[model samples]
Target: MANFIDKLKPALAGSREGPPTSAASRGPSPFWVMVRKEFGDHIRSWRFVILLAIVVLACAGSLYASVSALKDGQSASAASGEGSSSFLFLKMFTETDGSLPGFLTFLSFLAPLIGIALGFDSVNTERNKGTLSRLLSQPLYRDDFLNAKFVAGLLLIAVVIFSLGFLVMGMGLFTIGYPPTPEEFWRVVVMLLITVVYVGLWLNLSLLFSVRFRQAATSALCGIALWIFFLVFYGMIVSLVGNATSPADTAAASVVIRHQDWMMLLSRLSPAYLFQEAASTLMLPDTRTLNPFITQDQAYLAINAPLSFGQSLLLVWPQVVAIVAETTVSFAAAYVAFMRQEIRSRS
Candidate 1:
């Protein structure tokens, strides 16, 4: 019996020397492990909790405004026989009681803050604490770390955005006792997706700054500065340029069209403008032209006619694509920069 046990002991030793057949060995990969860790950290962070509360309060205020406005408009719409033709679900998003902006407006303004807050210190915080080099010292690829951080932030954004969307829908349903039509529900879903992409742009931008700057505050300030520039100053700059280069009042139709085209190109450079344009078109099916210069013939064809779901999507595809492209560019820049960045352990 002793000889037989000894013979089997070498086999067990060889198996232990080889890859251990344990559950830990079969667990998630290193990339996924990093992703989970980052996700957990984001969820438990105080900044996220505060931002979430602010967003919820703002969204609730806007929602109440919308619900009140809808209730007040119901009588007028019913008397005029417009209630049946109107979209109640969409109104819950776009309507307000003259006190607050609608849900989309609030989301557009606040989503960037959430993205920026979540990502501004993603890398620099680690480096400042002398853990970035230690983290990279593990059996993890450089891209995996960066990619995991981005994916984790994006996942958090999606969770928050989608939760707010459904909350609005649920509260509206409970208060108004009306469910959205299939088309309206899908439109809302698409708008939520666009909001995610919009926030993602800021996330990647801040992540880029986090990689480039050693200080978290500097990264955050840089992100906020760009956000302010595009939100407030970019539009003014575009308008000033448009006014300086405006065609005369008596200019030819083609010349005026050319001028408007130039202005549109410049304005579209702002992601907020693109998001607003896309959200408006999706939420309001009556929108036919992104530019204010629709021809008489085109206007005649669109009079009293709402666009179909597919038509609305087609109209805003460029804006959606543009936002996506900008996000991709930002992420790629960050990825390349992080890969090239050198990390040294602090003694």
Candidate 2:
């Protein structure tokens, strides 16, 4: 009996020292482990590759068009007395080819798709493959999974946005033969950051749908539907509502002003609208105010010179706040939904 007890004691001691029993004792935090896993998976996936290639090609084409237009504009300005020859580096982002939209416009249009693509299947795919249960059974907390996914998606977005912004600037420098001014560089950086935030909002929205729906297709379709509604139909609806609420006769300035303000408020409810307003204001320094009802004095102040970077940011600060608030609300909702979700896989 003494020998038997001695043998068992060795076994017990070996088990105690063999492996970690708690998550913290692991080599790294589960959150970071999961983040690295998700980021790698995203970068390697065919979906990411295809989408990134599309964006790069589109940007390259848009930059080509913009540079050509800038050259023409510069030559015309040299020939004419009306055009000003300042901030040519900044013009590369804001200037349009005959009918083509600028680089910023292209970004605003496609950035949401990238975010949605990254998040639409984040959870549902794991569940569909019967991995969610196994994954959660590891030494990890539930929130870690969700938080890691959100952070991974955000990091992906930041990389892509900043890379493209830098690429555009580099191409512009080679072709336009001028570097961006300090103010222009900072403005571009701010625009890129805002774009990341804008796309992050869509990422959270899609992630929420991913958590709520068991099917990936359903979540993807829901996200696309929301995007279409905001991007296409929301503006039309706002216009109709404003016309319906407006006075029939254009006699009262106050009434007209009220109607315009109501329309602006309603339009801002859409993330797409908020992003466009903010991106446009950031890219184009000449834009002084988002408010259409600026007083004569304000208009007079803005006519002779472009607003400083600080003033431009100030003008769009409300839009920035609204976008950030919407992003936070979406992420919070996703976090709650994921936390309350059942981990059981459907047979």
Clashing pairs for model 2 are none
Off by over 4 Å in 1: 1-24
Candidate 2 structure quality by residue, lDDT tens digits, 237-289: 99888877888685688878887888899999999999999988988888877
Off by over 4 Å in 2: 1-26, 301-303
Candidate 1, 171-277: lDDT as tens digits: 99999998899999999999999999999999999999999998899999999999989889999999999999999999999999999999999999899999999
True-structure RMSD for candidate 1: 5.5
RMSD after CA superposition, every candidate: 5.5, 4.5
Report residue 145 deviation for candidate 2 (angstroms): 0.9
lDDT scores in order: 0.92, 0.90
